[model samples]
Target: ALSVLMPKVKVKKNAKSGKKGKDKKPQPKVNTLISKPKAAASLRRKLSGPEDVPVPDDDSGDLDEPAAAKPAKTKLKAAEPPTRLTRGQRKRQQRKENFLRKFELANLIGKQEEAFRTGSLANLADLTAHLEEDKAPATAKGPKRLGRKAQAAQDEREMAQFQGVLGFKAFQADPFGALEQHLKNSIRLQKEKEKTAAGKQKAKLSQLKEAFRSKKRLGTVKNKFAKSRKPKK
Candidate 1:
């Protein structure tokens, strides 16, 4: 009877507030290294959400089937025709081969010499023969014609050599010798012309004097005057 009387006095009901319908913001998930048991529990939680979705099996029937064999690889290449050497290239190759052959011969000669020095009696005669052959005077020949380019190079070299025929020392000592010679010739010619003109003038003056004497328009005057003195005008 006493409890009923106390509750009957008042029972205030607080409002539910706005928490019921408001949506909560989802937080970003962070994954830490978890033990197997923790991982299994987490997997269980995830499986609970997607219970209808099918999970992939680790060993499917496809793994039991044999895989398709890979096709054998083939290298495809274009057939290349043999290259023909040019005339110049062929000549150069031949010359190189000849040079190599000569080098071998020289090596053989050198070995023979070495053997002779070691008192090999068998090699001594051969070495002496070779030395004698070498000592024999060889006939020298004029320069060989290699090719057109070589001829051009030779011409250029000859021109250069001819250009320097007047020794550089003399040219450096008197660089203006040619010019000086030219100037001297000019001066000599001018002097000759002047002497000729002087001789001509002297001859003309002598002729005039003879003409005056012959005409008697000269000398003995001074008394009456020369030719009447032009009428005092």
Candidate 2:
């Protein structure tokens, strides 16, 4: 009765105003937690649109071009067969190699000695120049075949020169023999000195032993009393 007495109010219902249409399909939910890089790349691809790669036609002029237009490969040369050497040739080569090896050793030894004497590093160029000057003869003569004696004399002269450079006394023709003789003489002298020293030592030992024996034979107390009592006048 109190609601009837109040003013009547109309309430409008909330309804769809647009015309009815077919129901739209719901889209699958995309993961929002995708990596930033992947999302960025996908966004870029979408913006760029589909890539269109050109397909080559088989009948094109490029296919008809000459094969020579491409780079050609270089062929390697075949190895040559080794030449056979005669016994004499082989022997000569061996001798030459041996000479070179000996020359190198001599040079190294000379350098070392020079360094030791000078207390400084020896210059290779200067040493080589000195060696060359020493080797050079006064006259430029043709190669001559030398006899055994002549060769030996030449060797002795060269050795003497080398010794002189090293501040050693010039050695005889047979340096080895002279050195051996010097060693032998020194040994002999040393032995003689030893023998003389031994003889002197033996004499001294014998005299001491004899004196000791005599003293022991003559009683110590009797000898002392005899010495103390003077000879009767």
Candidate 3:
């Protein structure tokens, strides 16, 4: 036999809730551009030189007196004079740091070059690990910064072994300086060659333009003379 489903019972709504509630208007938004009393106090403290910041007076719950009537007093400590480094002294310190950094980089590059010349896999592997340790991230918080030009020179010197045409020997005396000088000479020669080629091209173009102008003038002259010699129509 089929079973019948039970019907759901409905509850009646309360008559009191049927009445409409009073409509309330939304509160106006406060403009932040107009400074509040507390913000004004902070600004006053900032404008007043580095002495102790004045605290704003707090209003008690009792509606007695407004905070603006009496300003809170702050104990001002005497400002200490700033320590400024002299220009010459700053330069000397910077130069000293730079010299130390250059010395360190030179030593590191020398080791890599020696490893390369020795043809020892273990030495090269150790050099690789050492280089990884000396990377930019290692000095993320330090004052040591490797110059881009120096880094580029080091990279070229390392790859010079594969560049037979360059005839660059990484194991030579002062390999870094030698390779850097060689790279500078190469760049200068390349620029000179480019300048010479550009000059030649410009000369050729000027000659072509002059030749065309001459031909055009001759054609115009010939046309004018021919027109002058023409028989009366």
Candidate 4:
């Protein structure tokens, strides 16, 4: 039954995800471009001073108010009221909690995946459980971050070992030596391409020079000695 349902369920899922969803991978959310919100925040910071961290001006959710500054009394409106849920009030709270927790976890997973996809410095260590020894001393704080060497070695071994698993093996099966080799090949290929381009440019320059000389020679040749026009000074 599970075997029979698997393909059908997969088909339904795929059908739900139309053409655009099939091959489309979620974009990474880390590195070069952080989340859009982060990028927008950075822009806002640049435009406005650092203090432009738009403090939640209206803790009060007053949608009807005008855009301009409001009086303190205006900030407090009777129409706006806070909402509270009772312990047992929500129907199917257990199911809702289960679904909510699952959804939250999925969202978190997608976020992390996006970060990884974006080629951010994957904090693989966070994936593994850590102890107090792993963290820095909280008391002595300055520009608190992992030092150069620690950050360098942080997930190096872990990543390699993880890659050593079946997935890594599949990757290794690819002609590309460890992923680093593929990267190195890319850099080498780019440099070689530049070199080839440079060579072509030189060849083109040489051809142009040769063509110029040929044109000059052809132009200067005796035109049956009829029109011996003097060359322009």
Highest TM-score model number: 3
Whole-model lDDT values for every prediction: 0.73, 0.76, 0.74, 0.69
Residue ranges of candidate 2 with Cα displaced over 4 Å: 1-170, 220-233
**Could you give candidate 2's per-residue lDDT for residues 1-233 as a string of tens digits?**
33322344433343564644335433444334233667756666666798787767765657557766767789998998998999999999999999999999999999788887897754668888999999998787879999999999999999997777456443446677767877898999999999999999999999999999888877887888888897877
Q: Rank order by TM-score, top first?
A: 3, 1, 2, 4
Window of ten residues with lowest summed lDDT in model 4? 4-13
Clashes of each: 0, 0, 0, 2
lDDT of 3 by residue, 1-233 (tens): 01111223334444678644344333444434234767756655666657865656774543565546566789899998988999998999999999999999999999889878888687656778889887747434766666999889978987885566356455255767876887999999999999999999999999999999999999999999999999998
Tens-place lDDT per residue, model 1, 45-115, is: 67558556565686564656798899999999999999999999999999999999999999999987887
> Each model's TM-score, in the order given?
0.24, 0.23, 0.28, 0.23
What tens digits encode model 4's per-residue C-alpha lDDT throughout 47-156?
66767335467667566766887656645556757667676766567878899999999999999889988987667566554654566466765776888898889779
Q: Where does model 3 exceed 4 Å of error?
A: 1-171
Off by over 4 Å in 4: 1-177, 227-233
TM-score of 3: 0.28
- Work out candidate 2's RMSD over C-alphas: 33.5
